[model samples]
Target: MPASALEGIDESTWVDVIQKMDEVYSQLIDDEIELEKKNAELEQSQQFIFSVLSAMSDVLLVCNERGVIEETNAALCELVGRTDAELHGTSLYELLADPLSVERARTVLGNTNPARRGEGLELNLFDAQRQSVPVDANCTPRVAASGRRVGTVFVARPTAEIKRAYHELRSAHEALKRAQQQLLHSEKMASLGRLVAGVAHELNNPISFVLGNVHALSRYSNRLRAYLAAVHAGEPAEQLQALRGKLRIDHILDDLPSLIEGTLEGAQRTADIVNSLKRFSAMDPEDRIPVDLNEVIKRAIHWIGKGAVPDFEMRWQPGPPLMVMGSAGQLQQVLMNLLQNAQDATAAHGKADKLVSIETEVVENCVRLHLRDNGPGIAPEHLSHVFDPFFTTKPVGKGTGLGLSISYGIVEHHGGVLSVCNQIDAGAEFLLELPLAH
Candidate 1:
């Protein structure tokens, strides 16, 4: 019955069905061709990546999520001094001679993601000789298309060159530090020597004056005692009193009172002078503290003005208290050096108008200090080297050239800047700008 029913239908309808089927099959074949193309491209890309890794100058390794070495390039194998057969199944630490190295590597790899770069750790890798060779290594996390967290890929280069460079830099730095310490010691000794000379010169006058005054007082006491003894000798008491009155002893005794008082006053003055000298020289080269610039200026100038170069007029433009984080003794040295310089420059020039003025104010966030002197100004050539070690303009016996250099180091350590410039008309002005603590 089925065969008989088929006899009524036209065969061309079946042709159309066959053609549709053929078209569908054609499309399927096309899809298959396209897939093969994609497959080829993927194979080529993998090959390219593998080649690049093999050619890399640094050791490269890829690990699975379990920290198992899934793939390693030639450089990595050679670095561990092992073949790929030995390294592929091994953990990163097992290949590294020390467990700590692998632990650090794991840490580094943990931090690696697409968002971060320029992060790495440098450590030592043991070579075949069991000697540690430095290596700079970094690892980052790599994710897979299966939506799972993959293990880290480590890329490291032998750090022998960098290690050598570091050793050289360290050596140089140590040498520089020693040189600086020696220079500082020499400078301290020099300063002490100058201080000794000044103190000796200063103390000699007071000592001499006191000694002479004591001698005079001693002689006067002896004479008076003898006179009293003579008066007390065996004559009638009333007669002796009458003789003393007749001589008008009260008038003569007035002169003696004056002499005694004068001698005591002179001795007190000498003592005060000696005390002041002690205070002035009490400066310590290493003591650091918060200090007022105004007080430092006043102390230095007052101490210097006591006996030597007393004719200079010092003027202070009082301003707000200038506070600084610095060494008190160092700043004192800087100011004292400046004032002494001013005095020397002005000694020959000023009769009464010899002047040194200290002015201070704020410039933005920095404190600006100016010490201006009306004296022989510095030449332009000497201005640049004022803070340089062993650079001094004074005659050979006078200046040791370390005062300004040490001052420069102190200011630099405090993050301040010091500079000197000659005034437009005459004299020199030093500018010190110190940034306030933030």
Candidate 2:
């Protein structure tokens, strides 16, 4: 029946079967072409990514769950001075230069999902020369399309350059701090020199007067003792009286008390000058505390005045205690410097109405202080450099010129500003502004 069925098959049925087979074959060829295109595209994409990884300067590594290096970038190969074939199948932990780092990496890799481990890890890696290089490393998990953990990827950067940079930065900071300290010391010495000069000049008269009076008193006492000895020797009362008269005992007794009083007053004046000098020259460089600007200003005024009221008419417009954080000693020195400068300017100009005005106000959360002198204003050309160290307008010996510069530094340390400008119609006006403590 099979033979008879085959013979009975029509030519048209055979042609139709052949046509159907051709159609199926054509469809298979088209599918194969599409598959090849997709494969080529995928290969191209992988090559692009591989090229990118190879081009990167940082070391990149792909490791399997066993912690065996499966793939590495050109950077890693070059760093180890090995070809990829030699690097592959190597233990990642063996590449670490530090024993502790190797142990840490091994422990981390023991986890089922080793990815997301070793973030911010600083490790020492061995180079081809067996020299250790610092590096920072990060790891992340590689997952397959089916959501299975396939491997771990590590990205690392050489930290030697960064460490060098950081070390350089710290050195620069230390140098800057040293320079600042030296500047502070220089300024303090300059202030101390000025204080010495002022004390010498002001105390000279009183001290000299006291010494002269003491010598005169000593001679008077000797004369008086001689007269007393004559009386004690039982000489004639008239003779003793004559001796006293000849010695001028009456006038000596009368003037002794006044002379002693003048000497005492002069001594007291010297003491006050010394005390003021001590207070004004206090240079506690590192003390910071809450202090009242008004009180400091008043003390400074008293010091600069040197016992007697200052020659210039001075007025203080004080506000409520303006509390600021600063060194009291330093602030006092600052005020003394400013006041002295004003005095010199006023005295030089010989103003008939020599007036120095000081005022304080609170504005915009800041404590503002203003000091103005009725003297000639600063020249425009010299105004900008007024606060510059060693800058001066007076005679060389008359001024060390560190007054304003040091004052400016003190104010800055207190988070304040000191500025000077010429007043509209009179002299130079200085403004000291400080931020109020919260």
What TM-score, computed on C-alpha atoms, does each candidate reach? 0.38, 0.51
Tell me the tens digit of each residue's lDDT in model 2 across 163-272: 89999999999999999999999999997786567557667877888999999899899999999899889999889889999989999999998999989988887786
Off by over 4 Å in 1: 1-312, 317-336, 347-354, 360-369, 388-390, 395-419, 424-426, 431-438
Q: lDDT for model 1, please.
A: 0.72
Q: Candidate 1 — worst ten consecutive residues by lDDT sum?
A: 276-285
Residue 263, candidate 2: C-alpha displacement in angstroms? 25
- Output the lDDT of residue 105, model 1: 69
lDDT of 2: 0.84
Q: Per-residue lDDT of 4-87 in model 1, one digit per residue for the tens? A: 877867889889989999999999999999999999999999999989988998988788766788888888777768777787
